[model samples]
Target chain A: MPLPGPLQDLVAEFQRLPGIGHKSAQRLGLHLMAQPVEAIERLASVLVSARRALSRCSVCHDLADGAICRICADPARDGGLLAVVSGTREVLALERTREFKGRYHVLGGLLSPLDGIGPEQLNIRTLLERLRDPALREVLLALEPTVEGEATTLYLSRLLVPMGLTCTRLASGLSAGAELDIVDEVTLARAFEGRRPIA
Target chain B: MLGGNAQGKTNLLEAVATLATAQPPFARKDAEVVRFGAKDAIIRSSLRRGGYPLRADLCFRTQGRRAAQIDGVPCRRMVDWLGKVTVVLFSRADLDLIQGSPQGRRQMLDRIIRQMAPLFHDEEARWSRLLVQRNALIRHILTGAATASQLEAWDEPFAVAAAAVSRRRAALVRSLAPRAERWLEVLSGGCEALGIGYKPGIPGGDESMSIEGPEFVASVLEALGKSRAQDLARGHATVGPHRDDWLARLDGRDAAGFASTGQRRSIVLALKLAERDLLREAVGEPPLLLLDDVLAELDPSRQEALLEAIGDGVQTFVTSTHLSDLHGAWRARADICQVAPGHIARPSVT
Candidate 1:
């Protein structure tokens, strides 16, 4: 027998989510239906409130619950160094490492003309304004090494580097924890070319 | 090389070709090409290219994409290894360039472009992916699942890929046409004239359909906009370079429409020779030529012309079943090999 109207709609909603296929969607919908009414009510409230509380940080465009994200408000970060990322996800990822002691500027996306993403569509205007902070001496392009990412980085560098700012990028080679045997030839070739001396 | 039907003559050429082809048609070791019971197949070659000895390896798995290693180093991206070993092939299937569907001609043209541009494969691959995505997005729009404004998300990328692919193809045909004309003249002793023209599928506001830069991409986007109704009805893309083709004109007339059998053979050979010349000029090194049963189709005089033109400039591999077809000077200079179903023997040091 087919699912009832509401349950079928629930399954369809689940299916629309990324990575959840038809089978998973059906299972999840049935499980949700089995939950207590109060528990389901609380879950829905949490989802809505969490979404409502969060906002894009005015400074960096990272996820924030207020006008400024914790990173932008933090006084301890190295103001001289600013890392420009294509998305706020990178900001969270880098923060988890606690290695980069600098503030960040999120473009929200990259410039991919074919994909209908252009300079105007991204958080690029804020990125340019952030560069005017005299304390910031260097901008690190923390973009993926993909064609669109490269194009965006190149576009930014051409626009910003001439303004007397030192620009840098993440080194591309074999990823950390990746074995030498499994490293790809292009990366291997680059690794060999960019090999550093052990002092 | 001498081999009967279904022998390993073409296999040797395919093995060499595997190292060069960006997308090996049989890379997924499934039917006829990979032996009936084999899980995987690998082809390895070491040869002098650009006067430097290079080692290339191609690995084909039953269920995954093919992998390659150059000098024993695994390629993370095949683009690094593609075009490193180029080959110009002439097989019985090549007759389709004049007689078969447009798809065959496009495949042959794309292979040449892939080798010449080096990045053409990546661009074309991207185009193919965007085509699928854009088609789905179009479907979504037609069904009210997505807004028309969201179409730009896929159209922009699709246009980029379409422009790049068609531009390279146009450039290749532009350069190839004159060279093929000259080669055809040489083969026919100035009796035949050839004209190759690339027909870009995009509208460019003129009779001439040449794919240029930004304007070409804008044209594609516009064409996509115009074709939205038709595309919606079909539930797929109906515009772009994916539908590009080239036409051959013999003596200022459509060759495919009314060319003699002998004249058609000469056209194919002229096209093949022109490809070899174009590749050599582009790469600064002659590519390996694989001729499989093509000699039998050409007349005796044309055969001599081909051999004389080749003159050992590039490494050439020829496979023939009839020994009588190959004569004195050519037979004397070539290293002969006997090919059977499962084995090959170096018979003589001719």
Candidate 2:
């Protein structure tokens, strides 16, 4: 049976979100309706406040509750080194490694021409502005090895290399402890192409 | 290769085709290509490519994509596994090239192109991806979730991919047309004329536009822009190379409209031969031809013509139910293997 007006409206709103189809939206709507009115109000307030409070970092463009993100504000992190990434998620992923002493510069997205994303659409200008800092000695491009990531890396390389910056891309290949046979072909092939001679 | 009806001759061909195309030719289910009792199957073959003997190993699991290796090195993609072991297969169903829908002819041409140039697989895959992404963007626009600017941003890359696919297909058809005509003359003993034309679905209907240059991309971009309203209405791309096709003419006449069965067979055979010659010329080696019980379908004279054309040094495997059906001349020099229920009796090569 068709849902009542307000329930249908809630389901429609849910359906607008990515990956939530009509059935899932309807289920979510019915489930939420069974909750207390205070519970729904609390959920709405939390979502609204979180979205309104979180803004981009002034320095690295990572998600920030204030003008500058925690990483940029941290004095222990190396200021001379910058790891360029495509999104805030990548910043979180790199932070989880616990090995990266440097700060991050998230461009928000890779250069995907097919998706209408180019240099202008990304935070490339801020990236260029950040590169002017003399303390920033080395730059590491921590982007995915996808076609868009490669294109963005190359574009950054052309812009930065002439300025005598030491720009490096992420090392792509089979991970440590991964089985040789189980490694994907693209990764294996990349490992071959990126092979270096050991002294 | 000699085998009776329901024997394992066709299965052998299907395995090789699967290895070359990354898709099984005759089976629907993924596991159907595997042996009836086996959990997995391994096809190991060694052939010389680019003047070096390369060994290819293909492993097909009951589920999941097949893995392929060339010279003990894994292929980066299934396309890399192609062009290593090329094949020219002509079966009874090949007559459908003329009679069937445009998709059949497109697929036949694409198969040959994919085998000859492995990167064609990459371009075709890219085109498919762009098409899907573009359609999704259009759907978003239709639903008011996105704006037209997003679709505009996607149009450039989509147009580039569409242009790339159409250009390669046009070039393939262009090269094959004359060769197919020449082969037709040779197959029909200089009496029949064949004409092959690429029918790309360019917006302005200028197939000649896609044949060359940067202008193809511009035209495709314009076409995509022009069809934006239609695409928005339909929630998909209304213009692209995915709907491309080629036409075959017999004796300077439209083969699809007026050709008889015998004429259709001759044209299809000629196209297959043209494909073989094109591969040979490009690769510097003739592809292995697999004739899977098609000799029995051809009349005696046409069969004689085909056998004569397939003459000499080219590696060929002709399957038949009886030895008498095969030419005596071929039998004198041929190493015939009789395929029975469970085994094939190996013949001693002269």
Best by TM-score: 1
TM-score, chain B, predicted structure 1: 0.92
Residue range A1-199, candidate 1, lDDT tens digits:
9999999999999999989989999999999999999989999999999999999998998889999999899999999999999777788788899899999988888765345565668888888888889998889999986656765777677778799899999888777898998775556756886888999
Tens digit of per-residue lDDT, candidate 1, span B253-344: 98998888788888889989999999899888889988877877777898898888787777888898887777566687788899988788
Kindly give the stretch of ten consecutive residues in candidate 2 chain B with the minimal lDDT sum.
B202-211
lDDT of each: 0.80, 0.80
Candidate 1 segments exceeding 4 Å error: A1-88, A93-199, B25-33, B203-207, B327-329, B348-350
In candidate 1, which residue pairs clash? A114-B156, A114-B157, A115-B157
What fraction of the reference structure's interface contacts does model 1 contain?
0.00
